[model samples]
Target: MYKLQVVKELHSSEGKMILDVDISVQQGSFTSIVGKSGAGKTTILRMLAGLVKPDKGSIHSGEDIWFDSNTRKNKVPQERSIGFVFQDFALFPNMSVLENLKCVQSEKDEEQIKELLSLTGLTALSGFRPDALSGGQKQRLALARALVRKPKLLILDEPFSAIDQETRIRLQQEILKIHKAYNLTTILVSHDLTEVLRLSDYVIEIGNGKIVRQGNTDLFFSNEGKTDQFRMTGQVVDLICENEKCFAYVVVGTMLIKARVEDSMNTALGIGDLVVLSLNDFNPIIKKIKP
Candidate 1:
């Protein structure tokens, strides 16, 4: 398991933003930290990656202590066993796919590098430079490069947000595949709800300098975490029933969600009715919005 407890002051165009984070993640779990901009989501990842230092507190993964402000023990970014994938692919424009993978490797392991290229389906483009590859291909190369060292913790910061929807979905699947294949503990910071719901085993929502809502994916669906930030508020924009199963199209903010309405939902439930959706069970629960 990994635990991060840190406090830091950040300066932005608006003002000082204090980030107080205390979170634990189980080993091999795919965790997603989500929130609006400047919610301290990425900061937490940076701190974990040893890219940023905290004013106070510590970070631990398994038996290794990554940081400890009290002891003045801090691991440099290179010392921490972390694979960080950035929002931009961040590949070396001058390096070929093979060279990029080789640069991060602590030791030359030919088979491991070959495996990564194949795992990300970049074997064919192994000699191609970042500039020559398409966006999706570059993203895949970035993922491949991050895995070169076989880091125990994989941190992704909105790595797929730049691509088109279809490509994003495909890459999401690829990440999941790599996670399981390596038994890696993965952490992602993304604002896309569907991606979070689809990828995360645990979801943490940060806001107001603290965790606004958090739980394993299951808790978001149950009644226990209804107040969580993962809750969705929407109005039924359309309803259809066919073959004994009912479906409702709900407009949640700017996103449209389609739910398989259970039999419990009365037939009288129609268009324009307010509804609440929860993100536990990795399934969205459709319920009438309470007064």
Candidate 2:
């Protein structure tokens, strides 16, 4: 099992914020972290990976002591057995795909490296360098390299951000297969709600550097019934004509919002109609909203 109890402080030109988070996960479970950008998702992962310090609290992963504020015991990233797949797929420019996979281990790493390459569909591209591969291929190579060391915990930071829609779906399935095969303790940070619901056994929703809600994926995405409790501020601006349907253009002050039209309800709304679009009840994407 993995346990976390930490208070982290981050400083940047934008501002400073404290992240007080506490959570636990059992072995062979997939946990997902979801939040807007700059909500401390990456900070939480960095702290878990021992790349950042926490102002208070402690972190315990099974039998190991990762961090403790009072005792002042902190381990380095190399000391922890963590497999990390970055958004950029940080492959080495000087090495080929196969060579990058072998960098973390000695003579004992070849078998694992070969297995990862096969699993990630990178075996045929073993000789290719980082620049020669496409964006999706590079992402796969990063995943393969991360798993070659046989880490107990796998951390993925928006692993599908740069891939196309088709490749993204394929990679999601591949990750699920890998997780089940190794029985890995996986922690994923993602903005895609569908992917989170599909892969995670447990979901943690963060807002303002704190966990706002945490629960099982089914309970979180349940649509058996509906409610109108979620209301986001906006205004109707334009009517985008489509073939069989239409989209509403809602102007929330300087920003414009686009929502699918169901019926004459949008027809009733003319340009410059003040409205509050509700999304507090469920977590859904703002399809055409300008951030």
Candidate 3:
């Protein structure tokens, strides 16, 4: 079991705030932490990963003291058995997909690395660099690299926030498969409420740098049911107006989709107007995306 009780002084969007969290996570279970912007969601994960220092408190995992303020005992990030995936992918721009994974391993395990590549569906792009891969591909590479450490705790900080909706959905499934295959205790930080309920066994809600609620995912969102609208931000690359109906071709990261324009004012779409594509029941429609 993993237990965390930490306090830290932080400067968030809400100004000076104290991050006080006391939480426990079960072994081999998936949990997600969610909160408003600047509520100290990422800070908690960073502290747990040893990337950020807590002002006080302790962190223990299975009788091991990862951090203790009173004793001044702290383990460096490498010492803690953790695999952290960041939203920005945090990949080496100069390295290929294979090299990124190998960089995290102190002792090379060729078979394990190959298996990770296959598991993440990156075998074909093993030789490609981060610049050559799509947003979704880079995120996959990031995840694979984290697993190279064979970590006991996996922390994800909004890892799918940068990807398109379609890729995000697929990657979510892939992550669950990875989590179960390794039997690792996983914790994810995401802003999407539906996503939290979909992937996590347990959900935690933080507000103003404190945990407001934490419980089983099903119970937390049982009354809400599924989400009605899914939105994707994309740039319009092509548009055609025929008989007062405008059809737009928008590019969302690596995916190109065609959408029917229907804005609030029924304005004509330009060739380069940024748009938001909303999907419900596989039918995607377009609207003006505000900056």
What TM-score would you give candidate 2 relative to the actual structure? 0.76
Badly placed stretches (over 4 Å) of model 2 are 12-14, 223-291
Residues 1-291, model 2: lDDT tens digits: 888898877665569877888888778899999888888998888888988888889888888999888999999987788999989888898899988988866357567887888898889999989999998899888888888878889999999998987688778889989999998999999987667755798988888789978888666545223434455565454567788767765534223345666565645655444455656346322332332
What overall lDDT goes with each candidate model?
0.84, 0.78, 0.84
Work out candidate 3's RMSD over C-alphas: 9.4
- Candidate 2: lDDT over CA atoms? 0.78
Using Cα atoms with residue i matched to residue i, what is each candidate's TM-score against the true structure?
A: 0.80, 0.76, 0.77
lDDT of 1: 0.84
Residue 97 CA displacement from its true place in model 1, Å: 0.5
Cα lDDT over the full model 3 = 0.84
Model 3 residue runs over 4 Å out of place are 223-291
lDDT digits (tens) for residues 164-264 of candidate 3: 87788789889988998999999999986646655788988899888987788656654333324488886765566788876776656424566777654
* Cα lDDT, model 2, residue 78: 78
Worst 10 residues of 2 by lDDT: 282-291
